[model samples]
Target: MHVLVVDDEPALRQILSAAVGRGGYSVDEAAGVVEARAKLARGDVDVALCDIKMPDGSGIDLVRESRAANIDTAFIMVTAFASVETAVEALRAGAFDYIIKPVRNEEVLNRLAQIAALRGLRQENKALRRQVRERSPVYRFGSPGMLEVERLVRKVAPTTGTVLITGESGTGKGVIARLIHELSDRSERPFLSVNCAAIPEQLMESEFFGHTKGAFTGADRGRKGLLLEADGGALFLDEISELPLPMQTKLLNVIEDKGVRPVGSEQVRNVDVRIIVATNRVLPELVKEGRFREDLFFRLSMFQIEIPPLRERQADMRGLIRFLLLVHGNRNGTALDIDPEAEEVLLAYRWPGNVRELENVIQRACILAEDNYITVADLPSAIAAATSPRPVAGTSADAKSHLRDRLRNFEADILASAIEEAGGDRKLAAQALGISLSSLYRKLDEMGHA
Candidate 1:
């Protein structure tokens, strides 16, 4: 906690500031009411140990003005008068605790400790409420690129290293960030995820570094920004390239110094948070264009992981489709199935929107499906057009042959995709496809590929 010792007496101010500093808290001193008010107005002072009577003005008056301004600093009024009226006036003026003249260092330390505990509890409560939100299951990857990304995540999760994940939009960068947080020693701590592009440029600093109540217009109450709120945890900053130049410098400072000074505040507060940033845009290119800082890019790229787009990982497509189907089925309380033709269309699409688009497509299909069955007509027009021609309903022998050929070809593709995902290991492929080894071999043999 940061403490401000306010008193006109030079000796008392020095003595208290030294004592508070020795007690392991950052301490600043102000002489008289004007100086104290100036220091307090900054909103950095956590607790102000102020003298009741000063040459310029009364501490009670200062406290009343601070309260009216909504500055949330805790005030501990000190006075030599020791009268009930003085104590009552201090408390009414928003003083946290009162101290008589000739203060004992021990008593002051105790009061400060109490205030620290109260602050901890308030922060804890906020974190707890945030933790109550449900988390979705993280999908495991089968492609070599994703496997390597997973390996990096595991290797760095146990440490305090900052992570920079580069991927296309909707490619699950946020999911990777959460996986690292959940695997880390600080998993129990809060994990905050914020989209840099979503926040207004004007509010970026205040949102990231917190602000004192009344620090700006509409700031009715104090806020402990994302860094403080994610203390001892992880903060995922998605679309990091959207951060303004000024905020970028502040973020780099937090990375190097592990501290943040709130807007309108003069003092810095220590924070311990593991930052994980993600961006689709090439940061180095931005630096070349004079849009991003080179120093910040270097710092963030110290440990980087790039996620491959979904189109480049065809082997994982079938697995992802099945997983999404199962998830949506469980959520909507419906047993959903997709037609082979529809599944073929999905597998063939370029998926320009990546995993996020695939998920949306699946969800929409599930909702549109009749009798819990998703067919080609249920899919989006662009996706449905990606596949080969579908068989027409007919009783002719040629039509029967064409339909059988199409179904056989679809099955072969599914098996090939699964085998590819398993790295040509048939046993693993069979297990992934939930089929027996004998059945897999028999099918492969019948397909004349063995």
Candidate 2:
């Protein structure tokens, strides 16, 4: 690992640098915040030891700057006086650890090693989670609201009760259903998912329950249905509400009996498979209107989970964005940064399409971003348009308030436009706007767009 030592005392800096170098790392020395910032700009430093007091600026400023840049560099604050308030402030500013000024070489080395180990574990866990997510056929969620969904998944995954997942189109209801199956004891068994909406009413039964060789016009040969294929595992019925009334009745019987009757076969085939249903529409409303079977609705909704829209949990947007960028970056062999201005625009706009939309946006931005950073101009035109505000009909109390509102909107629009233009290259966009990247990121985070 490469370490940077920032201190006003040249002698102290040399001592710290020598100790860190002896601990198996390259060392860089900085006189103060200005020099530290310059070294950071050059990049590749993994950790920094900064003195609390400096001639130009406090070390807290350096800590804050490092965090804002989204740098993974760990920080250790060194102070002559370790007061409660100073330590608290240093930690709050994002320092990894704090040490007294008369730090022993052994103590410093030990803390550095600990931080390295912890950071390694965190990276490993992240990689493992990413692997699991990618391997799962259906299991997609990167929003805070989905945390509840995950909890419920864990609770019901081991159970035999039927599960009904409800969410908007493209909101990943299918993914949740698959996760439940994968988490269950029958994970090794065959898992099949059928989209009820895609099958025609005439073929729904045959598709789900199978048909005999001479059952229908197209039943020239015997074939196994999804339920039979999913024996000992899970059968996921997506868009369950789209199933016709007759099919719904047949499904209800199959679930209750744990067996299947082929279209023309007299033989009854017993199968033990977990059933999971997902729909975007409300089944209760359908049942009340006599469009769906009430008994079937009751049977399928034994375990119900409602996935909320992305707008409700905007706090997770940044984490999700970061995750997606890493995903795409790994795939394309490129790294990307999110411009603060563009991030603000993203957070401000209500995502009607939810997580799916956010993923799509990020994917596009990744492709479009020419530089290391993703700016607002890289966003889709629709998002840019939505984020830009127009003049309100009502008047404000004062010109300042009116100007403030207008300026806010104007800033949002500029950020959005810049990101769109930069193809979501935040660093490049920040440079274009003539502001420090850290400042841009901070501004965007404050606007809830990061």
Candidate 3:
């Protein structure tokens, strides 16, 4: 932890700094509010210990300024005044804790620990808020397949092994990668992501390793590579299969050596980086076909997670659609409702493009929809095309069979609509459907949709 000590008294500042440093934290000193503000502007201070009365300004003012700037640094006010009124005022002004002057070393350490815990709580709360805001009811799934996948993610996320996530396009691989990072110890560090398929092959190396000034025609200043930028953090290599063979070798070397040598620089810089790779390709086949290196595949696949396709988890469809409706509605600042008949048709249709396709359909439906609720007519031509086929008419036994088949189709259509709206992930789809993963899976199997 980095600590800033702010006090007007030279002796007090030095004594407190030494004590803080001894407590396994780096210390920066500021004699007054002006110096403190300058130090804060540089953006490295994590916790600030300030005197209530400074020569230039009050510590309360500094706390208020820090809060106004949206800095996450924790503040503690140290002063001769220890009255309840003074403490309350400081707390209201954003001081994390109030400490009396002539401070004991043990007391200071205890208060610092409390501040650290509070900071952690605040960070967790922020993360939870972001999750809630970004989340829609659409990703819920009650299938056994989804439960197993969740269990695997929980097991593998905390390990040091490299993870390779594979799935069909738009199957929420990116979300899974983020969940792994969020669950890991490196959650506090930077989580850098690069889509290999998006960047041109020529610029791939430079983008990953960075380039020193004068290294290339356009090079003006030394640039820190993304690998270096993600030092002591995670580097998410999305669509890793898109990388050319030559660049793959270099990336493999970096992963193995735990360092990188920037372009035009002979000096090697060590890095502490965790890699999480995602791809939509069949990597084993690619390796056999000689398109990908077998060694590199082994290095990346220390832990492999294969996300099931939407069709395989059809029971999650209904919840997914509702989730998507809410998401699109919230994003567009409009309210949308889905008719049961339209939703049933949605569940019956197969989502060839997976979750991405579902989101596109919902967005389209929302824009075209004239009423509060979305009807079958509001759905896209492609979705209607896939869902309009009818069963043949027959006799008594056949009639019972046909009726059962029709009911199953209706259920499938509802599930598909939910999944589409939820954005194709089972967990969110299940939540939107208000069912468990096991029940969703059972429904899918019964309908021959899984």
Candidate 4:
């Protein structure tokens, strides 16, 4: 691994460079942020040790800038006891790690060693994905819900318009995202996905926008963020509603302007990439509750597609099972068979976690099956308890809950159709529905929408 040591103090810079060299890594030293930026622009450095305070500017600024520039280098901030608060700020801006000074050789060496090992695995995964991007996945495509999903994918995938896929978790949102990318003119380019909820709030901005080297505390190298990486193809932002309010504004600016400036960099780069985002949450409700941006919601919803939950499309279960079985079987080096009783149990279960949960169950069953046949014994406890061929008649309490769910779906569909017919004029929709505008507003509120 190549490492950069940036500190105003020449003695500390020399000490750190020698220590990293002894650890069997090439090392470079930068006296300040300006010198660090020059080294980072080359993009070969893998990690950097940056001081929080420097002559040119604060290290925090450098960290933010490096990430904005899309340099994939990791940064370790070197801070004094009095600068702990500033160190905290740097951590929020995307410093990989921070050390309190006077920095010791052992601590710095150990941290770099761990980062190098983890970075190796990350790079391997990226390379593997790139090598196989041409071999697209094949879907069984039997369920009406899934068929509609496929149809919608093909319908919108060919266009470069932004898309927002809304569905319950595990309904194959990622699969659909990839399908969109594959069908587009930019298919041969790159497809990148970022899970908004999975990233730390502090680092979200730097992750999306490339940063310049020495922009902040630990930023010793420049970075090209996800936006630039997906320049010629599609970028999927899953769980996008989880993005913080401040970042939401920045994202909206990018979507509207088609230009991005890295976290601390003054340069704006025009990018050409399709945006496909997904979320399981009810965004309208979130907007009403003041958690999501309303204008941004409208921008992303230009081509919206919602994938139905697994329970709603049980008709496709058989084909899904057969395909998943063959897949897991080949993977496990076994030809697996499911007994009639086991199939009954799978059919009866609600599958609250959708296709993803089903895949896990099937993989587990494949491992647990005896003599190549999977039985109820191999199923999860909840699913195993469900064996009746008929839908188990529920009690009065359950009936009310079930009826309420159906009514809600029915109402939402009616409202949506009416609004669409009126060309999205809610007042006209209300008149067409033979209801007062106030009544329509009340219904919308009750239905958890604006």
What's each prediction's TM-score? 0.71, 0.57, 0.59, 0.60
In model 4, which regions exceed 4 Å deviation?
A: 1-136, 331-334, 386-450
Q: Highest TM-score, which number?
A: 1
Over the stretch 379-422, how does candidate 4's per-residue lDDT look in tens digits?
A: 76666444333422666644444323443466679888999999
Residue 325 displacement in candidate 3 (angstroms): 1.0
Clashes of 3: 42
User: What lDDT tens digits, residue by residue, belong to model 1 across residues 1-450?
Assistant: 778999999999999999998987778889999998877776667899999999999999999999988787999999999999999999998999999989999999999999987876676566567655645667788989899999999999999989999999999998899899889998877788899999999999999998875789987666778997787778999999999999999999999998888877767777889999999999989999999999999989889999999999988899999899998755457678888777887887788899999999999988766667776646766665454454557656545453335655667898899999999999999899776677678667766766
**Candidate 1 Cα misplacement greater than 4 A, ranges:** 7-9, 19-25, 31-42, 50-70, 75-121, 124-135, 211-224, 331-335, 388-450
The runs of at least 3 residues in candidate 3 whose Cα sits more than 4 Å from the true structure, single-residue gaps closed, are 1-138, 331-334, 388-450
Counting only residues 3 or more apart in sequence or on different chains, how many pairs clash (N, Cα, C under 3 Å) in candidate 4? 29
lDDT of 3 at 168: 92
After the best TM-score superposition of candidate 4, give how far the Cα of residue 412 lies from its true spot, in angstroms.
48
The models' CA-based lDDT, in order, is: 0.85, 0.77, 0.78, 0.80
- Worst 10 contiguous positions by lDDT, candidate 1: 397-406
- lDDT, model 2: 0.77
Alpha carbon lDDT at 247, candidate 4: 92
Worst 10 residues of 2 by lDDT: 396-405
Model 4 TM-score on a 0 to 1 scale? 0.60
For model 2, the superposed segments whose C-alpha errors exceed 4 Å read 1-144, 388-450
Question: What local lDDT score does residue 22 receive in model 2, on the 0 to 100 scale?
Answer: 88
Angstrom error of the Cα, residue 208, model 2: value is: 0.4
Kindly list the per-residue Cα lDDT of model 3 for residues 238-271, writing each as its tens digit: 9999889999899889989876776765545566
